[model samples]
Target: METMNVQEHWQNMALDQVPLALAGHEVPWVREARLAAFERFAARGFPTRRDEAWKYTDLSILAKRASFAPDNIPPDAPSEAALNAWMLSRQNVHLMVFVNGHYSPELSYPRNLGPGVQLESLAGMLDENAQLPPELFDAVHEHTVLDALNTAFTTDGAVLRLAPGTRLKTPVYLLYIASGYGVSIYPRNIILAGEGAEATVIEHYMGTLDAHNFTDAVTQLELASGVTIDHCKLVQEGSAAFHIAGVHARQKAGSRFVSHSFALGGKLVRNDITSSLDGPDCDCRMNGLYLLNGRQQADHHTCIDHQAPRGTSRECYRGVLDGASRGVFDGKVIVRPGAEKTDAHQSNRNLLLSRQAEVDTKPQLEIYADEVKCTHGATVGQLDEDSLFYMQSRGIDAETARSLLVYGFLNDVIERVPVSELRSRIVDMVLDRLPQGESIKELL
Candidate 1:
């Protein structure tokens, strides 16, 4: 009898899912993509600590974990009453629900999108033989094994399209609920906005406390000239879950794109965001905040490419680490040779709340255009004792004052969120994690 090593185990896992993946996806090109991705993943396996991009994060435990593929999760959707706690307080938004990576139409709310708007699930479109993009899975970088796995085993996700001059009045909510432990979820979302199109999308991932699942998600977005899109990703997975997600956006001339990431809970998490400014006057803004306590860990990596003249990009990311948790931020900006007049700025700041907590922050700039203006900086520090003392002297208790300052540190990023209702929801979530948070509710 031969014992399979960790790498061999993962490769066999992907190999075993080949029949299921190819059987479910009927499109010729899609089937080819799945096989290609599966082969790549089976050959390379997961990234190791030596890989520069993944050097800071250790994924050794993933090899030892046993999990069921997306197709293996039972198709039973939970009752409406069981989802009350997970529903957003905002009642006017359009909704799409997924249970263990399978779309659930019965749980999804009905909505009337205006003319020139189309919304459909990935599975539904495939079943109906919809004309999908040949490059559906080609928009983002598939350098990591996590991405390869997602493409190989993606069960279901959302697809949104907006014709030229269309404007969506309400946000589209893509809620992914994890209910089965030892289950792996791969969700793939696609958004296409034509010229002068405008919309907002919210991607929320939540799960039960007992769920020890593995989630690998990816989203691809395309914006035409004069288009504007706002995207926010919220993660509240179980404490024992391992989650990895990526967002890739391509922008044309005069297009504006903004992204907000709020990472609140997970055993281990990683986020990757990349934006390509392919046309002049394109604008990209990214904001993120992560709060990690206990032994949790979260890593964020972002890149902005200025491929044309007059492109603009701005990024700000902050993290708060408590207990023995760890945080990492790596941001990069690149200006091509002809990308003159480009303006780019990036900043990463982290706060440590315990002696054992740690953070690794890096902000990088690679410029080939001489006329571009680019700047990047990173900071890692603890709470300012002086500021805390001043607040305590002003009749605020130590605990309340500390909580206020922590909230204040994150307020700037919260203020950048344009959706008011979502902003309030984020505030409430943050407050719940702070000590004596109820006492400072009035102050907010």
Candidate 2:
């Protein structure tokens, strides 16, 4: 008997499983694309610690686990109370819910979309017409194995499109819930904002506590000239779950793209986000916060490509790691040649509450243009003892003082969230999870 390597195991899994996964969709191009993606995955294999991009994180545990396939048998839908609780009781929002990568019409609210706005499931679109544009799968770079796996196995996800000059007052919500045990789900989403259109979208991923699950998600967004989009992604999966997600956006001239990401759950999680400024005068802002404790590990990687002149980008990410958890932040900004007058700034800050907690942070800038202004920086440190002592001297308990200081450290990034309700929700979630959170809540 011969032992198989991790890459060989996955390659065999892709070969054996992808055809069965494509049972429902008879689209020729979709099949071709999936096969192509599987080939890419087999060629590149999974990244190792030796790989520069994956230096701080390791996926050996995930790869060694038994191969997981899509859960064809749908589990029971979550109760209304669970849905409402996870949604934070947000009202007047267009909601689309998925359970195990299958769209649930009963749990979704698809009404009142008004004119020039379209929201539906990508799988539904494929069923209606198999001739969708091939560019939908061209968003991410072809070198990533996980992305290729997602492309090969993705069944359904949210699809939103806005016509030119349309404005949607209500935000769109995409909620993904994992219910079954030891299931793998691939979700692929696409968002298109036409010229002069404006809208907001929020994506939420969650699962039952203690359930073992894996979620591989990919999202691609395109903003035409003069469009404005506010995007938020929240990951609150089970403590025993593994999650990997990627978000890619392309911005046209004068378009504005703002993103806020929150990672608060999962035993192991990785988030990759990239934004390309393809047209001049485009603006992009990326903000993220991660909270980890116990044995959890989280990694965030971001890239901003300034491909045109006069583009501007700003990024700020903060993390709080406690217990024996670990965190990683890698941010890169590239100003391509001929992209003059570009302005980009990136910063990553981490706070460790426990001595055993670890964090690796890297902020980099590559400039090929002469007249560009770019700056990058990273900081990792424990909570400020001076502030903690000052609060303790003011009669505050030590635990409460520490919580206050942590909240204060994160308040700056939380305040930058554009949606007031979401910001408040984040604040409540953070405070509820903090050590001695109840006492600090009274102070707030």
> Could you estimate the TM-score for every candidate?
0.95, 0.95
Q: Mind giving the per-residue lDDT tens digits that candidate 2 earns over 145-200?
A: 78887887788898899999999988898989989788888898889889999999
Model 1 misplacement above 4 A: 1-11, 14-16, 22-24
lDDT of 1 by residue, 162-236 (tens): 999999979998889888667888898899999999999999898776567889998889999999999999888
| N/CA/C clash count, model 2 | 0
RMSD of 1: 2.4
Candidate 1 has its poorest 10 consecutive residues by lDDT at 1-10
Model 2: colliding residue pairs = none
Write down the TM-score for model 2.
Answer: 0.95
- The deviation in Å at residue 95 for candidate 2 is 0.7
User: Candidate 1's error at 383, in angstroms?
Assistant: 1.2
